[model samples]
Target chain A: MPSDSSPPNRRGLITLAWLWVAAPLAYGVYELVHKATQLFTG
Target chain B: MSSPPVAPAGWSRWLVPPAALSVHLSIGQAYAWSVFKPPLEAALHLDGTQSALPFQLAIVMLGLSAAFGGTLVERNGPRWAMTVALVCFCAGFLLSALGAGTRQYWLIVLGYGFVGGIGLGIGYISPVSTLIKWFPDRPGMATGIAIMGFGGGALIASPWSAQMLASFGGDNDGIALAFLVHGLSYAVFMTLGVLLVRVPRTGDGGGTASGPSGPSDLEGVQVSARGAVRTPQFWCLWIVLCMNVTAGIGILEKAAPMITDFFADSSAPVSASAAAGFVALLSAANMAGRIGWSSTSDLIGRKNIYRLYLGVGALMYLLIALFGDASKPLFVLCALVILSFYGGGFATVPAYLKDLFGTYQVGAIHGRLLTAWSTAGVLGPLIVNWIADRQKEAGKHGSSLYGLSFGIMIGLLVVGFVANELVRPVHARHHVPAPREAADAQRQQPA
Candidate 1:
């Protein structure tokens, strides 16, 4: 077992996990914003 | 009290939020059900109201399953709970696919509404208590991160699902294929949450309560879910949540039309496209408020933040009631603010529960409290729609149609404000006895 205070190297895993959610969310927000522009434009 | 795969030494607590987001974002697709409605209605030859039954039932089931499954999730641990959510949620999509393929509306209802709703309920609460435990120092911000994904899920899902429907074609076979893709992909996505999640190791500094240093920090009070509902504080929070959700959902359900109606007779009438944009803006506000305002609660305190939601929310209603047609910007601003408060109310409550009732059985307690949401889900839209229908019958139109509804929302907000005021720390009597004390007491009691 690792020592109680030890910090494991999970930097890559964390990045991958965060990206999985963020990428799609960014896409959705982009579309939503694109659609929403019509309110001001029209 | 949770399942195994506890956070081993050296693990970063930060991984938990993404784990939670995986589940929340997937289930948050519930909000994007409207995207499927038009396609389903067209393929199934159903009217708007008939097509709506699935989403409505799904909401009801979300509350019911959450209220019931909360304790089981706490008892079995998050992994077991998350796996259950995965199975139910993914299976729901598959079943809906089968239903759509067969042209059976009731099958789709059963698949998505009943089965999938259980996934929503279980998935919704699964990460909440774990997040609170993981980030005891900043419970509001911690829970806010995970819950924010729920709001944002629709943002991603709305467009993505629409694209899928477009590419696959909106016919029945196409919709079925879309459902198949959603189920399979979501299954893959949610697996990350199940695999990555770990209950915090004891004495990790982040997981356990560091100490109850403040008078407001009643975490050491340790009330069980059963003990909590008996306390007035639970009911007060219940009323608080119900009224807030009711007030917001009323506006949200009617938003696209409400904005148009408010300005219908004015010099600047809101066009259909602008109305759609207005709905999108409200969704943005709702999603933003979940993370933004809930995190703000960490510094301001939960009670103070709620006072802002209820108090300011009531004022916004009053503004709409008295002078909605007077200015378009003012009208939109008030609606956006109310929606943010609606989302904020959801994100802040678990942390608020941690403050009053402590982390003991909090997931279960939260589950029980969600019954209030179920109540509000029906009540808010009912009050708004029924009044609008009645007003139309009375030959009313424009902003006049929603005047009474806005007044009722104000009344609900006032009630919520009072309920927030009534909330205090749970009494010592309600606190669950420590394990040792319980053992000793149990030994003395006759079998």
Candidate 2:
């Protein structure tokens, strides 16, 4: 297998990936909250 | 065999699951199709069934494209597969917007169903084998995270789409705008997966042990997708998946209405809004089950976990059939457990495939297995809806309408349980031989 010669910081990349996952999930939560407000308050 | 590109230094295997989640979450929006149904029917002057064609065809295409494109995905690696998924998925939305703007239902079906569905299948599988390679120690948990995103996609999309429709008006123009936004936003969202994905440097040829967690016993044989189909183990699993999905989907496809019907005669009948709440709860159970139960599988063993899913799932159905209307709490508890099993079944199967077939072409094998899902997608709903319709015609009401369907589901789960019991490790004849050392050395050298 071709190995990476210049591997960057592993922790940074993993953190960045977690941010990507969190972005949508946060948006999803936001939407859910918005819907709940509409259902209860509107 | 040529080796896959090694991850550059600092590439934590942990980064891969999030990459997989990005793609799976975006494609999981397919589950929110119900939110679009009423609006599409009203705007297009179509019936409920007509409006459902896009969702139905998308599922069929998801299975077919996954099966046919599985090898392409495996050969090219996840980056290539995710790129194809991003393009097809986004483009399908763009085209659907055009179709809606022009009031052409066929175009909606063609774009969303055929094109987007291909994206769904490819996107769904793109991350599976990669995650397994990255987290060989916890295959079930790794896949569960990504597949859990798929189960939760609807939770995000349903309300978002509903709000968009509310704001934009439920006309063709509004629908087009929504489609356009969905296409563009998801393109940007799924790009994260395409950019972040990497195949393990160890390569997928079943040579190097993925991690310390990988099962030594499973190191025995690696079956090609072609060879796998010829084995009894594959067909047995196919039946197992189909029956499990069929049983869950039968109830899920009609959750809101079925619940209301079950309690129509109660002192405080289930209202439409309340029924919608019930659907949302089921979605939560479904999402939770994917991660929770699949993670549980890693500790208990895949075969054992399935015994619970298939066995307990049947018992849950029987509970509902016998005493569903007598108490609301009992009915809700049984339904929730059943939905969880449905989600668990989906989340755990890739790892199960890894167990039986090895990681060599497990993605492709998984894609082939999804054909069972497409089959169940049709079969489950058909059995429930057809039977319910007949019961109504025969003057049956309330829980009686679904009694036969629930009994049938129990029977199906029992069959699936038996099939799960029959699974064993693949034979050595099906294993792919390890790559020659000379070939590996040559590939490692500069061209």
Candidate 3:
């Protein structure tokens, strides 16, 4: 396994963790709309 | 191959709790269910009571899940607690979608009720005890940070859900689609909480060297989760939380319709967009109260602050009820303040537990105490919606129907006010500390 070099500082870790949680959620919302459209109009 | 290095604790630990907050704040926004009431009711041609089931179920789940899952959360840690929340909350939506598609009211309740309610319970307490352990010196502030997320969950959820409902065609399909999105989206959001959360090492996580932190001044003062339940203070706090939540939710469940009715036939009647804004504003107040009032508790003490939430909150309801259909700004102002207190009541209670019960198993105790909230979740909306439905049939509308509802809320708040006054310091006999286990906390100086 590669040695993880991300989040060199505490603030960086907070930011990285936020991104980790947020990106997936934001993506999920986008996916939700996409799926919703396919269901409604498909 | 080398193992992953651990994070050197302190300040670095703040990262996980905030992620937990993000998920909680979003879901807590579900309380702003009134924001969607008109459009949903119109689209489905349903009555007020019919439209309220999802919101009621969500609150029921929040309290039930939190109460039932308290011990499991303490044993398994935040990761496990939050993982369960994501699955259930998301599945609730999927189930709700099927219900909406089939137009089966009971299915909607079953899906969101049993499935998602479990998620709410686990998610609510996922971080309480752990957060307290990490920051023994500032238990109030630490728990406040995470709980604030829950307070604000609705602030973000209200607007986003409204926009989703609007975009997805604003009918049963739209509502169904919104539920699906909420479930899937929350699962993804809460995944961060699960991924990053960790229990602090026993013995205050690093605040002390040898063992768990305890009162340095007192020779022995501790209360385990099991023991905490037996205390008068626990029951006192339970009554306090239940009464406070009931008062706030009574307004929250009916916010959209109530506000629209209050302003009916006014020169500047509330438009659709403006009504949505009213719900959004309440969300902001609810979210802000969590952080603002709860943080204030650190300085003022939980008892005094609750005196304000209950006492002042009751007074605010009086203002709304007496000044029937009064100035728009006054109505909005009083409602906002009341909603803030509601959110504050939730955010402050964990720290209240820390102050009274100690951190031995606070998360578990906090979970168990949440059953009061579950009880209020059912009672509050039932009282409001039930009365309003009865009034609607009796040719009542607008302020008249709600006048009765607000009167009931005032009585509940007053009852809560009495409970707050009855809170006294727990006696020695009631508190049961862990046995002296050669721990170093005995030698530490008190904060």
Task: Give interface RMSD for all predictions.
Answer: 4.4, 6.3, 11.1
Which candidate has the top score in TM-score? 1
Q: In terms of lDDT, which candidate is stronger, 2 or 3? A: 2
Q: Please give the TM-score that candidate 2 achieves against the real structure.
A: 0.90
**Top candidate, metric DockQ:** 1
User: Residue B150, candidate 3: how far off, in angstroms?
Assistant: 2.4
Ranking by DockQ: 1, 2, 3
Which is the better candidate, 2 or 3, if ranked by TM-score? 2
Candidate 1 structure quality by residue, lDDT tens digits, B144-221: 888999999899888899999999999999999999999999999999999998776654534342212111123377
Q: Which stretches of candidate 1 lie over 4 Å from their true place?
A: A1-8, B209-219, B436-447
Comparison by DockQ, 1 against 2, better one:
1
**lDDT values for all models:** 0.87, 0.83, 0.71
Model 2, chain B only, scores a TM-score of 0.93
Q: Name the best candidate (by lDDT).
A: 1
Task: State TM-scores per candidate.
Answer: 0.93, 0.90, 0.78
The fraction of reference A/B contacts recovered in model 2 reads 0.29
lDDT of 3 by residue, B252-346 (tens): 87887887888786776666556656765676677678778888888888889999999898899889998848777788889989999998898
TM-score of chain B of each: 0.94, 0.93, 0.81
RMSD of each: 4.7, 4.5, 7.3
Residue B271 lDDT (model 1): 94
Which regions of candidate 3 fall more than 4 Å away from where they truly are? A1-8, A18-42, B1-11, B29-58, B91-111, B158-184, B202-220, B265-268, B386-398, B435-447
Give the per-residue Cα lDDT of candidate 3 at B8: 44
Give per-residue CA lDDT, model 2, range B1-447, as digits (tens): 223334554466666788888898899999888888998999999998899898888888899989998887777778888898999999999999999999998999999999999999899888887787777778899899999999878877887889889998889999999999999999988888887777654443222433211222234567788889988899999999999999999989999899999999998677776676677677778888999999999999999998999999999999999999998889989998999999999999999998898877888999999999989988999999999999999999999999999989999999999999999888888887644542454457578
